[model samples]
Target: MKILIIEDEIQLVQSISEYLQTENYTCEYALTYRQAVHKVLKHNYDCILLDLMLPGGDGMQILEEMKRLKKMDGVIIISARGAFEDKISGLQIGADDYLSKPFHLPELAARIYSVVRRRNFGNSNIIDENELQINLLAKTATINNVELSLTKKEFDLLLYFISNRNCVISKNALAEHLSGDIAGMLDNYDYIYAHIKNLKKKLNDAGCRNYLKTIYGSGYKWEI
Candidate 1:
């Protein structure tokens, strides 16, 4: 899954990004409110770690904008402001959870896991799509009880396709999703094709049906 850490404190943002990256999550950073708002509006994320205070503006404004724009990105408020009113206001504005500062990294990871599970996987750690079964916590995929030897990127690709099943996903979208914002500016997307090819081959080798489909000039789709 992907996470966005919106924090003004450079040290805090770095710490969060490093920790989350170790937890098998692709993370993007926003050090100021402008960057935060731009990322929130531009891309989709599994979860966002938002700080109430920012360099250019209040983090609450970011949440309000997300609400106004009807973005469904899961948000977790990570801030020094621990008052009940702040929590209520954030939740009312569409935050999925609140985590006060001076908390353990494991707790934050747990909160992210819960929010992402609820938002993307229907609150379940296990996803069952016919003969294919994926365990989110374990980060494993099995087809007909046989585990497929997949790289982390391939597994992430498979999960991304499943999450947006039956929808035509553009190459630009896939590149951004897997490679973060920088990939969006790049001209080439051949790396995405490589990942998809490897994922499909592994799935086919495991005796699974060919659910991965190419949309020709458009993109790719998981036609379940």
Candidate 2:
């Protein structure tokens, strides 16, 4: 899954990014309040790790902006221990969870996965949709009990589709989600097309149903 880290501590950001990378999550960063506001407005992520104290502005304002935009990305407020008021206020403003500093990486991973799964997986580690089965923890997919050989990008693409099934997802969103870089850094969406092509081929060849649909002028959809 894609994660956005809004933290001013460069060391903490690096540590979180490195550890989450090991857990198969693509992470992006915003070290200042301005950067956080920009990303929360423009980009999309499965989960956002938001720190309440920022370099330029209060992080609560960022959450307010997210609410203003009606953005649905799950947010987890990261604050110092004993800041119960901040935690309560953050949850009231729509943060899905809260974590204090000096936390364990494993706990952080579990909390992040919990928030993402609540948004997409419906409280299960496995997604069983008729003939198709996906193991979120394992990052694996299967059709009729036969495992499909998929690249990491391909697996992420499949999960993205299934998670937001029946919605038309634009090429720009797909590109940014799959890429570690920001939206402006992308040259074009040709790489997205390639990934979809390979993903379709693998699914089709594996005797899976053709649920992937291209929306002609808009984007792609999993039209289950």
Per-residue lDDT of candidate 1, residues 1-224 (tens digit): 88999988888877777767766789998998999999999999999999998899999999998899999999999989888899999998899998788654545665686688878766367988999999887889999999989999998778777765666667876776677657848889898888898899899999999999999999887887
Q: Which stretch of 10 consecutive residues in model 2 shows the poorest summed lDDT? A: 175-184
lDDT of 2 by residue, 1-224 (tens): 99999999999999889878866789999999999999888889999999988989999899998898899999998876438788888999999998887564544665786688879976467988789999887878999999999999899788777755666677876775676345558677787899999999999998988999999989887887
TM-score of each: 0.56, 0.56
TM-score of 1: 0.56
Global lDDT of each candidate: 0.84, 0.84
TM-score of model 2 vs. true structure: 0.56
Q: Which segments of candidate 2 are over 4 A away from where they belong?
A: 123-224
In model 2, state the lDDT of residue 3. Answer: 99
